[model samples]
Target: MKKRLIYGWLLAGVTFASSCTKNFDEVNTDPYKATSENFNPNFLMSQAQIQFSQTGYDQLLFQSMWVQSLASTFDYYANGDKYVLRGSGTGYYSRTWNRGYGALTLVDEMKNLVQGKTQYSNLDACGTILRVMFIQRITDLHGDVPYSQEGQAKSGNVAPVFDKQQDIYKAMLSQLDAATAALDLNKDKPSSDLFYGGDISKWKRLGYSLMLKAAMRLTKVDAATAKTYAEKAYAAGTMTSVADNAKVLTDNANGNSNSNSDALLVADDFREVRWGKTLIDIMKTSNDPRISAVAEVSAGTGKAANEDRATPGVNTASLQIGMPNGYDLNGGATDISKAPNYPGTSPANPAVPNDAPAPVGKYSRPRLTVYDDRSGVNMLYTYGESELLLAEAAVRGWNTGSAATHYANALAADIRSLAQMNATPQAVVSDNDIASYVSRNPLNTANTTALQQINTEYYVVTSTTFNFNETFANWRRSGYPVLTPVTYPGQYITGSIPRRMPYPITLPQTNGANYQAAVANQGPDNFATRVWWDKQ
Candidate 1:
């Protein structure tokens, strides 16, 4: 089945010659190879799912640094950490853009193949859900993208016009509504489905959850629409527990391993990353037990001789400390160890030698065994996120459940999710721990601080799960956690954090007119410009 999926994917990229030769005969064609005419929609769907997972996971590699969930000690990401644009020559922006649009093409093909066919209506609905997921990420990163006419290159529409972010959002919401409603239980399901295993109910829940997410993104710009969709989503049935989470399960096989684990193993410096101070300090002050589940104790030389020096570091919660953002390797190494309430097992010199190696391992890093585990699951949407959004919806006077109940459920779900993802004995979060944490952190009734508290908890939840894209977007929308802007030397956007990534450089060359229009409509193609949803 997997081999067929791969063959179909390969064939999807093939462009056969329009004119056939007189010599064309049976011997000229390969009988076993799949082609566009004979490709299975199920195989195409499977490939799309895998590519979508890869695209989403890759965003964390850099966006996590932007949100301060993880600090980079390596020079390669120093400029990115400080919000500096690496220029058109840098592949980060272009690579992400290509991956998103590439996946959309596969999805478009799958939808075209299955549409108007009753037997494949459910599969077509899945394609719609996948389309929304991919396009949303693109518009979020680079406002005013080629949406309405995208994936029409074969039809001679190479330079597709860019659509406004508002229009894109509206269209996506409508498509999701129709797609979820079109799901029929009587239809045949694809056995090769990667996310829900061809289960229509799970896909329906995911569609509603995605709709809720889209609605929340509009809170800053269009509260009325946000409220309307939020209510509809709840009624449509959103994810309510960890069991309903939309994730792509991966194995330890060579080509199927988790992307995060693969990247960690191949990173230039094994310890280039450490827990960010913003996250660790919040966890410590609140006595959050999930902190131990996420981080490992420092392995600095200053620790006691008998201290455990495990490969991923020790699992002592009290001994974990996070690295602060904005400083260079040497500066961070010296400054972090001297900060007030430093909790690392080892304390480094207040001033280290200029030539000394970065003291990254001296500070706490993410629990390696779990984050770098080959068989880990890649979460797309979670019950915790759904509950948190419900809490926000209630606060907004929407017809969701009680804010307090949703808040508590969100916390419990987050804790359970952490333990479930990482089965290490030391990282376990027992029922007692969840109960104690929930009891200690009840929702505040004061309206003034209620939103702040809710979003702050969201920041912590996203940090632990490495869901930095949503974390950054939420921070922009709610303005919670009150993070200080970094003002490092050579920074591109000074005095404030970046709001959006610039468009890829190839845009002007390939689609000049449309690109110019988009740039003119959406402020200068720069990081400082805000998207439509991020209203001032």
Candidate 2:
């Protein structure tokens, strides 16, 4: 019953095209089986748009734990929860690499199909924007990646050299700038454009917004360039409101639902995930209304005799607690009952018998009604994120806007966007609450704490939504709201939180020379080595 994007119809068209093409190929007997010219560019664009937003099962397993927004109570999830990167844990690295490059290949095919075609100039621009988006994610994960020589297997360069992160950033910014400027509204647009629905104006906003994000990322490392692009992006019209958010919609149907919902539905292990103590503590301290919107009360109240019980799954801001990271049943205690501060107060534990419920469900899980809802929107970029980044730009003396106004606007947009996740009345943040939160948490004018304040708010905003990758990246760049590194017994990287993910294990065997070259140029192929932009 949910509103579906037009992808289904487009996919059917692609299928029909494929079936019809077989007859033509059989009759012609051309040396090459098929060419890019044989396919509709819209179909390629549709696939790229969908694939670009597809984070799949890896995000819930790895990113959520890495950012400390979610944690696991069982040994099964200890690999990720405790930073143990062995056998199964290493799968996260491989899955992300595969998905990212797989999507980029489709974008490359689309680019090849539309390149140098005067009539499809706008489509070409769209392809470039998508390429930048896809490649940025890859470079962010691993410092040096195959950018220039990527997807060039047909050109006979199977072993492409790795591009440095700095070079990649420069190229991405240039591409975005050119692509955004080249998007002509009068030109024909793709009918299957899922993100913008063929609206060139919104596509332009998304392109500039991505530019803003790339520039802000270099704040610590390259202040001058960061300032330059941030100003240019703002002038070119970055996302200004929730209406301009670049989100992909779902229909709540099989094979068409939100990726997060799909993962949660099929994987029983994912159900073990609950809110992390670090995030919950901050939200509870600030009395953030988003906590109730994002998380639910423990299903089972571990209370003894004569205890008053609170209703399960109630949206009481005070009753929601989170499980701590980096402890398993075998590590210290027999179970949740024996663990110190079993479902401790602050966000109070449920009122059920101590031994009655499983430890995993004994604490708060993410709000299933919203987050796990199949019809939910997968937010890629948003006005809230842009405003927060701009707020930081203002703090850095960039000619964007007043820090106070941007900060207030960021808070308001974030609250309003959460309401759009579902029609739950409790999730809808009131204007009074928005105004009050903004007023209370005004940007710290003092230079010493201004950047910290802005980045910390960025963390809070990204946590409620499914922006864990950005949350981790910003944390590394800004180092705000200082997080404690978990020192679990069998942790792989010790003494600090991860700076970047390890390269996929298959890289050495698949592309040994290039893999070694990248490892040598960028620091050792390990989690502790900082990426180029993460100078802080």
Candidate 3:
């Protein structure tokens, strides 16, 4: 976010006409300040938007610990008998401050590019959705972060005040709604989408789907608001099929669109995290394929067969265990080195075992989020997610559609989407392969069985790589798909699963007043303290 880089890039496309010479001997350039008159709106818009979109992509993966340890569907870290998050751990500085805020800076430029241009009104739709996604990410992670005044940092008020989380959600919903409504279907913009090949309909679906997700986030403290947004999004036609899912491509060119999945294995901090037992056992009990899909060939290992866990010890004193995510077992640990063996186990299919191992190289498979691969880059606000949300909404009697049909559709969509991801060469699954299993494993609700089925699958799909955010959030909301507790040292966090991520260490210097006020209003502001939406 240096002033020099922003200015230099801001003028990326505009050409300069060199003035003949101020003294008739030395060359002078037109310094009247460049205008947008000659700039190609399409080119400028693409670069700006693409750069901005990468913020979420980068933060979600870039050695993020809170998400991996605290929220992954298949992992857990315990604080004695209770569980808690260790968000205060050291690896998160870049995510907490840099990538997210940096992306906001670019979004500001994108918004300016399409602003009063008559011919490029459709481009506004594109900018609006991406910007809102960034803003929501900021609010979701930090809660009450600077929204309205962010990215305007250089304008004398480099530090902007914080906005309320509730108000931020409302504004973001408004922006998503407006932008989706404005997107022109016939107008061709750019297909260079690193996620979805410039598919406007898919983008719009994601807009509405994200609106549902935002609304769903408030179910604890504000059911009425949650239902309102869910209903509106449902009526607005959110994701109806797997094809509509949004994603981010990872070619790993500079590492392409990929991360150095290998780099983390060497870091003590990174390898300390491993899979939790709660989810591992469940996958085994139901005979779910995702178990092998996530953890390495743990079936015969001591942890897998005996304790039914793939325990990766965090031998380093610095790392914490039993994450707030809630998926650990009594005797085993998860392995980070697992990422290298997955769908990427062979040279043919290109599956990645994205998890990192300890310096000793002792580890197992990684529990990847939904967006673990390039194909997974699609931002998935899926029919599966929508159906599950609706089913839950219906279970609560929020009133949008039929809970039964929604439940069934949720399963079908997720199964289809999941199966599609394995379509790679060596890992392909035939259509006739799992049809029998799907029909039986998650039988439609006879009594409360349907609720369990819906929530369990729902948890899995919410994660781009695995069910990272959804697992914790859904478990907190409905108390479903019952999981067991993990065993770990308590000094890392308080006695139970900590809820909110600890405010970054830098908060004291940056947004002093708001940071202090949050701690005052909400005790300690650690993992134990819940966000506004986490009702209990």
lDDT of each: 0.77, 0.78, 0.53
Residue-level lDDT tens digits of model 1 in 1-536: 99999988777645243233454676488888876567787888877777666533356445777778777555665655666544332467665688789889999888888767777888888889999988988888888998899999988999999999999999999999999998888888866787878888888899999999999999989999899899999998998688777777666675777777676655443446677888888899989998778888544443231122235567678877777876554545335444555443344334543323334555677787767777776666788988888898898778987999999999999888776564343357889999999999998857657788788888887777766767888888888888887666667678887788788888889899999999899999887899999979
Count: clashes, candidate 3: 56
- TM-score for candidate 2, residues paired by index: 0.87
Sorted on TM-score, best first, the list reads: 1, 2, 3
Per-prediction CA RMSD (Å):
8.2, 9.4, 10.6
Comparing 1 with 2 on lDDT, the higher-scoring candidate is: 2
Residue pairs in steric clash, candidate 1? none
Model 3 C-alpha lDDT per residue in residues 1-536, reported as the tens digit of each score: 59989888666634233233335333343655466665555554444444443433233332233323222322222222224334433345335356556766665665676688756666667767777766665555556677777778666776676676777878887888888888877887554454456777777787888888878878778878888888888888788887776544444445434332332232322333444334444455666544443444222222212122233322221121222333332333433223223221112112323332222122333433222343333233466887788777777676678877777676556656654442252222345545554666544545467667777767555542443434455555555656533334444454444355566677779778877876776557655666666657
Candidate 1 TM-score to native: 0.87
How much is the lDDT of residue 58 in candidate 2? 56
> Model 3 residue 343 lDDT?
24
Per-candidate TM-scores read 0.87, 0.87, 0.72
- Give the higher-lDDT candidate: 2 or 3: 2
